[model samples]
Target chain A: MIERLKDLWAHRELLWNMTVKELKVKYKRSVLGFAWSFMTPLVMLLVFSIVFSILARGGDVQWYAVFLMSGLLPWLFFVNSLMQSVGSIVANPGLVKKVYFPREILPIAAVGANIFHFVLQMLVFFVFMLLIRWHFSPWLLLMPFILILQVVLTLGLALLVSAANVYLRDVQHFVEVALTALFWLSPIVYPVGLVASQFPKFMPLYLVNPMTNIVLLWEYAIYNPHHYGPQVAYISFWGILITVVFSIVTLVGGYYVFARIERGFAEQI
Target chain B: MEHAVEVREVSKMFKLYHENVRSLKEKVLFFRKRGYEEFWALRDIDLDVEKGETLGIIGANGSGKSTLLKCMTRIIYPTSGKIMTDGSIAALLELGAGFQPDLTGRENVYLNASILGFSRKEVDGKFDEIVAFAELERFIDNYVRNYSSGMYIRLGFAVAISVDPEILIVDEVLAVGDEAFQRKCLDKIDEFRDSGKTIIFVTHNVDVTREICDRVIMLEEGRIVRDGIPKEVVNHYHQVMETEEEASEQGNRKIEITEVRLLNDRGEETNDFYTGSSMKVRVCYEAREPIVDPVFGFSLDDYRGFTAFGTNTALKGLEMGTVAGDGVVEFDLKSLPMLEGRYLVSVAAHSRDEQTVYHWQDKLYQFEMKSDIDDVGLLYIPCEVKTGPQAG
Candidate 1:
């Protein structure tokens, strides 16, 4: 894994070029362009904010908006990155067949591009909080740690989904349905706190969800510091552990599958 | 003291599919439909190249020439083979494989050069030399998409030669560029050859093969049919093509040419029919029809399959009313101007335009011109060159 990391790091220029190409080509002829990256989540955040405010029966729901934003932000990054990377190898079959490079670079490049978009949105998230007087604590310094977790989780999912997609292309379609289901299963719209009270039996299962801890930590760090206590630390620790393990397993497994199947790709393509 | 490259028992098989499944749904259901064909592009190809050796590969289309080069470069892996090389390899298996239409010429040159394993500093070091060699210095900043195909070829060739690789693999890239650029490329290849570098050139041009290659290998249907000195291999290749043409002609019609042989004064199998050499083109044919005014015409074509000169018995107003049944017709040319290359011959029998006994045997016979004399253009247009201290 360290050797693989070193290789990817050395080939960082290729990643930069690919990421820039993807970013430009995606919105090439569109009028909205890069703004669409921000516009999409902003639009989703708006609709979710209105509905949650109405449902929670009117309180100072600024925290509620921040909560929803935090959840949507990471989940959006994961979904977008996974979808793009799942199709990455297939999309660039010409490059893969002609050149000899690590196949994992394709998915990692997509993940890097998505991370760029995620960082841009996070800046907007900060402005949203600044508009309101959401108190910032020393806990905010750990945003980089949370961002790293998000990147790792996204990378793991992208690697797993993209690799599986080569053998079983049905995963691409299934991923969309799974994502929609996961959206509700995660504490995005409402809080995990609400879920614990509403359905006490499923509370432990919710804790196992990597995104649940991620969203919970993001909400705690930004919206409410009092809530960012031992639980957030515990959630962060587990999140880091699971993501690291998931990343390694997905990367190793994906590389094996890619190298094994790559020879057939030229003929298949 | 040793060979620059050694290839042992190299074979490559490619699996080709009828279609590419781009969408996920199509990919998932790909197994339901089954029509795949396996083709052996190369088989049991063994070759050895000494240092500073120029090896030419000559073959028809779909022969294993390009595949062998690709295997040596590791661009595409061989199914079973072992290749040992002494130094770095630079392959021009195709021109313009790495250029991006969206990028500028300068940008694409850098990108493609890097992809070909030249470092950024190396490209920078030879950037001016490459641009000057390509003759695209003025338009270096223009987007490659806007550039013409000639411009693209120039840049590709320039960048490839700049690598100065120890071993260079050239495909049919020279077939496109203009005459001047072709000369430039040939000169560059000669320079590389003289500088103790190894080159593997794949081309259909027999003359180029004979002129530049120390040795030539003939490929037919994914196998090496002949490998030897350039002149011998090329002669054998021409003989094979002539035989195949004769066989095909026999299969097509009632009139069959048993053989078409080019002979000197003493009748022996020889391809070397040079300028001012007494040559006989003997065509043994069997006639199935009652033939009258049977006009037999033979043609001399250059290496490119273009008829250089030809005339028939009836066309020349020599009324030789024909009585033909298993006879041989010979065309004896006194002096042929063609210099130092292979030439193909074709024979035909017809009375007039409508009633044809037999038609064009396009590749019936072949001969070679072994001249040390220099020819200015495509053909030797009898010329005189006098040089001394320039008299103003």
Candidate 2:
């Protein structure tokens, strides 16, 4: 394991270059270029704002766009990285079979590219928060730590699915289906309060989802629910601890799985 | 001196699946029931490349040459044993493998250099030389998507070549590009040799090994059958290939040449000879019916079917009476004209009028020609080079 780490460390430049390639290739010919990164979250916030504010009439939550965008940005990063990385190895058989670099660089680069876009979307989100004059949460001090936890968790899952997708290609399509289901399970579009009040017995099981607490942390920090509507949103001290521990475990476990099966990747790809 | 690369007890086995169960759905359906035939591509092979020595690997297709190179480069792991390299290795298994079309040529050079295990610091210093070698100065900033395939390969090659390393692993990549560029790449390899870096080269072009490698190894059926001097091992490589081929015959047999043998000066039967050495060709004939004034002839042709030397009894003014039963006719070659390479022998028996051929086997016999001469072309010609400033 230490040897592999040293190998990966030596190829760190390749990791950065590949990540840059992914980012540049993603919007290569577009006139708008990286503006699309900020555009996506803004469009989603607009659509959701109209749907919830006018149609659903959820007046219980003030400035609901703030609540939705805070969770939505992180969710987009999670889903996009997973979707992209899951197919990274299979997509680049030329690299996997022909070149000599740490195989983990492919999926890790996928997550790295998403990290750039995630940061961009967060910038857009904060600008909108200032525009709305939304009250700030004291928990915002924990924002950097939450972002790191989310990255660790996302990187782990990305490596797992990408490596798995090489052997079983259906894992690629399965992730697509699973992500759609997982979106609603987590409090991305909906709030944890809605689930806790309606299915109180299952709330404990729901919090067991690492994404649930991770999303709740995002909402707690950015939405600043203490000043807004605690009735529709919730964050727990225990939930924060569970997610922190869960993310690390997932990251370590994901790295282990990736290494064990990486030998088969060239042949399988 | 120490070994630059060590491969000990290395073997690779591939599982050939009957039905590829790649999808998750199919994998679940076929769980623990996937049927595959096992093929071992490499078998307990051991090799050590000494520092600064250039070793050549030559083998027929499916002989595990590529598998061995892949194992050495860590592209694919061996099923058993280990490979250790003492220093950095730059392997050109392929050209332009990881180039993203969207990236500019300038960007891809850095990306490709890193992909081949060169540090950015190394690339930064040699970046200009790489671009110049690729001849892409003006077009370096253009997106690779617009570059021609030739430009793509050149840029890819230039990156790998510019990264000087302790070891270089080349797998037939020099066969690409135009002939001029091929010469440049070979010159680069020669420079690498002069710089005293260890190298492992694999190619189907066995002749290149004679020019470049310090030693040669021939592999067949996943095992090293010959490992020695370049000329001998390459000769063995030809022999292995020759064994896989049989002569095409088309003639009626009133009289047949039952067997053909090549003998050296001492009349010892063999299939190997050297340039300027006496060789004897014995054609063992069986006459089913008596044939008069029959012409017995043989042609020594190189592998390309270009006749190097040929003769006939009639042409040489030899008249034979009726031959019956079994007898041997001998042709003595005072001194072999062959330089190097496998030579095929064909023999025939025909009526004097040439209306009837008794039996003719085309390329039925072969002999390996070894020589000390280093001159090029069809056959070795003895000559002296008179040189220099005042010579006319």
Cα TM-score per model: 0.73, 0.91
After TM-score superposition, the amount by which residue A63's alpha carbon in candidate 1 deviates from its true location, in angstroms, is: 1.9
Worst lDDT window (10 residues) for model 1 chain A? A227-236
Q: After superposition, how far is residue B287 of candidate 2 from its true place, in Å?
A: 3.9
Share of reference contacts found in each model:
0.07, 0.81
DockQ score of each predicted structure, in the order shown: 0.19, 0.74
For candidate 1, lDDT tens digit of each residue in B1-392? 26778889999898676775556668657766846688999999888888888999988788888777767765567789888788777778666665667677887777667555566677889999999999999999988888999999999999989987888888877898899999999999999999989999998887788888999999988899988899778866765665555522423344556678888756776978666566778877776755666677888876555678888877777765655568877777666677666777877766565365565577656777776665544456666779899789
Model 2 Cα lDDT, one tens digit per residue, A1-269: 78888988988989998998899899999999988887877788888787766665768567777788888889999999999999999999898898778999999999999999999778877887788786787889988998899999999999899988887787888999998988889887666777888899998788888888888888888887777888546777787788888889888899899999999888887
Give the number of the best model, judged by lDDT.
2
Candidate 2, TM-score of its B chain: 0.84
lDDT (tens digit, per residue) of candidate 2 on B136-171: 999999999999988998998999989988999999
Chain A TM per prediction: 0.86, 0.95
Q: Global lDDT of each model?
A: 0.74, 0.87
- Cα lDDT for residue B209, candidate 2: 95
